[model samples]
Target: MTTATLGRLDAIDPAARRAPRYGGFSWTFLSVELKRLFRNSSVVIFTLIFPVAMLIMVGLPNKNVPISDVPVAQGGMSAAVPIMISMAVYGAMVASTMTGVTVAAERTQGWSRQLRLTPLNPVVYILVKVLCGLVLGGIAVLITLILGSALGITAPVGNLVLAGLLAWLSSLMMTSLGLAVGYAFPAQNAMRYLGPILPILSFMGGLFFPLALMPDGVQIAAKFTPVWGIANLSQSAIIGTAPDVWAIPNLVVWFLLFTGFAVLMFRRDTKRV
Candidate 1:
């Protein structure tokens, strides 16, 4: 072989220098996604700031007022305490679920095609997106908790920790629900549907209002909503009460259902491509 030809082959040789793998959980990608998310003014205001502001407005002024005949789970706890917990869950759910909306946008931009060309695993990509949502949700939770504490929404340390844990964990349901919605609909349509559905679900789940205060039929129906079980658990944590045994089944069933829906949608997309 000619010396020039040998040099050209050497320059192009895969054995000489390995191509960088794009697979796995990438911190660089994570950072980029986070920055992208934070840069969106709407996302920042809606997901991170709004919940805290709401708590301050509604909760701070009423911090000292004792809510009479609050629910059994609320025990002797001040109304502000339960409101803070619910808002934390509400914020976390919104933040995490909204992450799925990016999926719809990415699909519209053919980002999914670009992703398929890389070494990144599809599952890892999904996980990263979910993690981004979780991060935002966690930020909202922390901010709400800090503001609550500052505004005199007091609870035992253990109760605070438990409430946070339950609220955060329950947000996974919304994350999956968002993913399913994103995969099933166009970007604009996904958000449109979500805008109305979110508040409705939150209301039905008793995140915004107490199920105990609702009519008997509404209270019975609230049990079927995805947020109800987790909200109850969080409320019980704050009030130092035992969660109902039914809460376990409620959370598990809805989580699995949402997760399954997401998986089905993802698989359908893959088949189409």
Candidate 2:
């Protein structure tokens, strides 16, 4: 209030007056976001329940249809095994993408603006959201694995675990894609556009069927879809083969592309607010 008081306040270190910096990942924020996500009924149904249901419907019939006459230990697996893993990947993609899509709602509700006023770092906020998406994705994978096991899809524990992990991690690309879409479009429009595209991408990526079974032209184009590399790479763990050489590059390129777009859109959205 007074000049003397102002002088004393100014004399104190400026850093001490500043709000605490949340420079890195915030576990507390992650927990809060995860709880908020789980509370949403639609999220629970689509991300957790839908994949398992699909597995039961499509996978049950194929459970005993072996792809090769050899044993699972010799890199021979049941037809249902890849199908189950594909569903896990698909579920993870849906969960992570939906998690990113929530940003649009937050923006519309002024939540993003409010966050700017807190000590929460913007990057940390984004990181927390992405991690929340990944957590949901992981849950989807776990549920699928459990159902797959109950349905008699068997493999070595190590291979199954590795396949599940890859399926979970592969959804990271979709998290960025979701953020980019959420920041670029309205909440309603984001899902409206992305909802149909995911399955199409999955089909093109060979999640719904084997690329070998498709026509040659479709097979060639399948290699270019965003989901192809990750899907193939995840299945390779169970198939007991080295992943195609191009799989890693496809994933890296798409992830970087989505992330760069997300950053740009995020900055533009911030400016508008």
Candidate 3:
């Protein structure tokens, strides 16, 4: 080779050539994911429309019904308050779990394999999925809250805001659970198995009604369910009561459990590829 060609060859770093490209998280990728999510009309219908509709149907008649003997000014809230919050939680749960559909689709399309070929860390990829789920969940909660306000579900502004925050935070576990299910099942089967979990948990956790109204057996069981703590915590502000002492720990433990399960499944899927 000529001297100039030899110099050019020598300047190229072997280490750089061997290193993987596109290794870290990027906001651009997150934005693309969000946009892709919103493009799905089903997501909008299920996460936004359904919840608001349920809130109106259930909350309108109960708007003036007092939840307890205490007055609203003295800390008691309307029946509509809990109904509104529960529907919000329900919507958020559905939105978060929809992550499974996207993940399974990616796997089916060989996108997971493509990602594996890049320097992108698997954990970062999973984090991006979780964030997308959270964004969808947040939107679900917000839309429900706006509808609730219009339907006359009144409460202190602080309580309303706090309840909304708690409802959004409660979706973290659902996001991780969605990732776990997505990584565990085939594309077509992922959502089929995942769809009924939230509604069942909501019923058992007394999100649809007071635990006290449940049978003695159900009330006891509700205390141990994944949704119970977060549901109670979210509603406590509106109810003007202290949440159970176990609420925080319950939320933390379930989040860790789901996150761990998701990581394990992700590693397994990666290895399979």
Candidate 4:
């Protein structure tokens, strides 16, 4: 029989391992998350079908209405055009809630704790969750896009290619936000209260209403929430315009803040010897 030797594994600094270690997370983990996301009827109805319904609701009767004296050829183009952006923002918030529930549920099932016991780096575990959530959120966005196209909902000036890029980057920011929430709260109780949080933020997001319509100071403060900034950028893009420079920076800052918070919490959790 072959003999093996064991030594102080923990003492062998984690940095020495050039390649990363992971919890039970792998392609298997990602596939499972995707499958589970689809299986959840509420997620399907809310994140998936709800946007389509909203699109149709807004697209209706607007076919002959002019939004702003601009010939909307076959369109109000949906004054609810902003709702596409709003829908995405809404979905991402749901992503945060849903992903947090995913992690929390996984933890309840002992997946996270067991994975932590692996050779996997804590950082890798956190990264994978965030990446997985981003992918899920991206898929949801694509579904919304498909519905918009089928409904004859025109995408302002943005070509599909440009819009895709915007969605990818915005999803990246949102993934980080989701992770931050996932790390901050205990999974179970979070979901219980998280349901209400989305609508409040969506309203605060200024998606249904223009920030200009709000008080000046509220508009300024809304910039701190990544949702507001992305909503502004996406709405402008859909309206056939480029977002202002400041808007991009707002997204970047929130992205960094969320990333930092998530990493810090995950690292602390892994410190158990």
Candidate 5:
């Protein structure tokens, strides 16, 4: 070996050297999955096009009508930037979840078995796929936020960055949610069933609507929903209001629960095949 090569090898401690090999399966899976996504035109529609479209379809001009979940703003969708920004996030989450679940349906086509047969560990494969969802979801969130800003909707750029960061973090939690439900279905029809249902929940979750407009009891219930916590955390960033610190513990618990469920479900699915 060249002296430079010897020096490079010596510079890496044993732990550092072995870490990459240990994580190689996940890195390769992330790369290959990303390549597959880029090559597929239809996948583009689901992950990219649809998300952007949703933002424009509902968010742009936002001049059509206005409403506010906050009593102070009581109007239509076009009135409140916070509520408007949330609609984009809600749409993106629904789209991202549906996209992940549809990928699970490919499991029946022999592709799943073939991938599993490769050196990639099942856990690593799942992790990489989930991470891929995060990547696309983060992009979707950014586009939605930027669009919200451009359309007469305004906020401090710092506030916008904070909102964007919250959205990205929330997307990771959504990735786990998607994986758990997607794997649980074990087939495509479940995704079909799920495709429209969760978005409806968003209305109650206060995505584009205010809980204030709902019954007080119902509004209290909404506060407990996973998406509600996420949206609340994000809105706090936008309005420059401090988020309820309690939202953090609730979010952490939900993320952990969803992740655990996803692992259990994936393991069961693997054992069956």
Candidate 6:
């Protein structure tokens, strides 16, 4: 019952004796990925610099300018707060979505294929990416808020906190877009598309200018763009005013659409490998 049993047990197939691999989420992997992402100088520099620069340079001139014709639903914040909010949103969104560039590079290096050999589920992998992106985004948001405070951008404590939270949450939509591009294109080509496309989306979403100040057609079109809803929501939060009827629903729709699209593209890309 001792030596004989031990010999028989050792003779069993080593593969059969190994534990069954059930794919699931991994926080340890996510932590490593976050640390790796933070080490990228380009991402860290961009996230740290862009929003503060925009607030100081672009916002200072218009700090005291009241938005003359804002609707009742939109709050009564000065131009400065909206500018701070928009720039913060822009910085966070760009930083978060830029993770896709990393993802694209990983695909180029065959990392995605290697990921398939692990016990991590695909859904969990994407979620981890999104969470990492948000964490990076939060850094940008905090910096923007601090810079805004230094620049004398003021609001109620609750309003400031709410706007910062919304800005960070809205960045997830861009993260989805980035993941889609990474999976759908090579890294080099993905950056080519993303670099130009980001500012355009930012403009279209009314981050550069208030929708009320735009022409009616542009305002209508802005409602349908990916970033506008979150931007608007964040803006309203900063001003302590209600968002438009479409803001929350529009944000929800775009977030879901982009997220679903990313999942589908990732599955398709993985299947080919």
The list of candidate 6 runs beyond 4 A from truth reads 1-23, 68-77
Cα deviation of 13, candidate 1, in Å: 15
RMSD of each: 4.5, 3.2, 3.6, 4.3, 7.7, 4.9
TM-scores for all candidates: the values are 0.83, 0.88, 0.88, 0.78, 0.77, 0.87
Q: Candidate 4 — which residues are off by over 4 angstroms?
A: 1-45, 58-65, 74-78, 271-273
lDDT per residue as tens, model 4, 1-273: 223323554357776766543544578766766677567676556666665565566544454455576666634455545556566555655654475456655555666567666676655566666676676676666776777667666564454546544654666665665565555567777566666766666567676567778998888888776677677677677766677677888778877887787677666654631
Winner of 1 and 4 under lDDT? 1
> What tens digits encode model 2's per-residue C-alpha lDDT throughout 44-137?
7888788998899887788777788876556667888888889999999999999888888878989767765556555566667778888889
Q: How close is candidate 1 to the true structure, as a TM-score?
A: 0.83
Ranking by TM-score: 3, 2, 6, 1, 4, 5
Q: Candidate 1, residue 164: CA error in Å?
A: 1.4
CA shift of 42, model 5, Å: 3.3
Name the lDDT of candidate 3: 0.83
lDDT for residue 254 in candidate 3, whole number 0-100: 87
lDDT of 6 by residue, 1-273 (tens): 799999988898956644334446566777899898988989899889888888889887876767657622355456788899899899989999897568898898898899766555666777878898899899999999988888777778999999999999966888888998899998889889999998898899988976777899999888888888888899989987899899888888988888888888888888888
Give the per-residue Cα lDDT of candidate 3 at 144.
92
lDDT of 6: 0.84
Which stretches of model 3 miss by more than 4 angstroms?
1-23, 70-76
Q: What is the per-residue lDDT of model 1 for residues 26-135, given as tens digits with 9 covering 90 to 100?
A: 78889998888787677777876888888988777767766666642455467788888898998899888887677888788887667655556655666677788888
- Residue pairs in collision within model 4: 21-120
Question: Between the candidate structures 4 and 5, which one is better when assessed by TM-score?
Answer: 4
TM-score of 5: 0.77
Q: Could you give candidate 5's per-residue lDDT for residues 56-151 as a string of tens digits?
A: 665565544444453323433344457545754664575456546645766666566665545545556566766776776776776667666666
